[model samples]
Target: MKIAVIDAQGAGLGQTIIKKIRKEIEKDIYIIALGTNTFATSNMVKAGANVGISGERAISSFCRTNKIDGIIGPIGVMCSGSINGEITPLISKSIFNMECTKYILPLQKHGIYIPGTRNLQIKDIIEEIVFDIKNNLVLIS
Candidate 1:
């Protein structure tokens, strides 16, 4: 399976998610790290993503053409003008239009609050995400 992990800004969250997923999933799943900037992509790559790419066009084009099985990122990924206005319209549109399962981390700092997820820590949230992917794989198989 191929999964894309998209992030921006400092990429701390994306790095954490990549590390956790690598530890939890023993299978040879390809993890692509897509970032809004070079710093973000570099951090995720250091965290063990199979491949890393940056910039608006790179992200949009890859999502538009790639056969990604799943995508994981903050809620800002789907919101145009989100992530301190770093998420462009094209990036948001491409991500939203992609035919893949999406796992969004609920971060209230972006002004996009997910109900019932207010108190969860980032680690717990990532654990849930990994669990969901594992369960989905079982179902698919």
Candidate 2:
């Protein structure tokens, strides 16, 4: 299966997800990195993603076509329209409106507040993602 790891300007989270996927799933799978920019995409690619797509245009196009089996990242990746720097409305709408499956972390959920996240390790995020995805696979079958 193909999985898209979507992320904000920081690719660390996407990399964490890739690491988790590698350790958990033995089957052949494709990791598509959809970054908010080139830096984020490159980081994820270095981590493990087979392919990386960056830039606002690329993100919107990818989402529009629904080319990925699933996505993982922060909801802020979908926030747009002058709300924050580089958060365009088109990309935001595409991400939020898209119907693709996601392996969103608990702290990344919409309207969910996570306190004192300064020291949260990447491994912790990976573990949660792995657990969630494994559960999802079982439930779907």
Error of 2 at 61 (Å): 0.6
Question: What shift in Å separates residue 113 of candidate 2 from its native position after superposition?
Answer: 2.5
Q: Report, for all candidates in order, the number of backbone clashes.
A: 0, 0
TM-score for each predicted model, relative to the true structure: 0.93, 0.75
Count clashing pairs, candidate 1. Answer: 0
lDDT of each: 0.91, 0.73
Overall local distance difference test of candidate 1: 0.91
Model 1: per-residue Cα lDDT over 1-141, one tens digit each: 888999999899999999998899867678999999999999999999999999999999999889988999999998999987879999999999999999988888665667898789888989999998888777766
Q: Which residue pairs collide, candidate 2?
A: none
TM-score of 1: 0.93
Across residues 3-114, which tens digit of lDDT does each residue of candidate 2 receive? Answer: 8888766777778788778778745677889887888889999888899999889988988886666788765665564224556777777877777676555453445556
CA lDDT, candidate 1, residue 58: 98
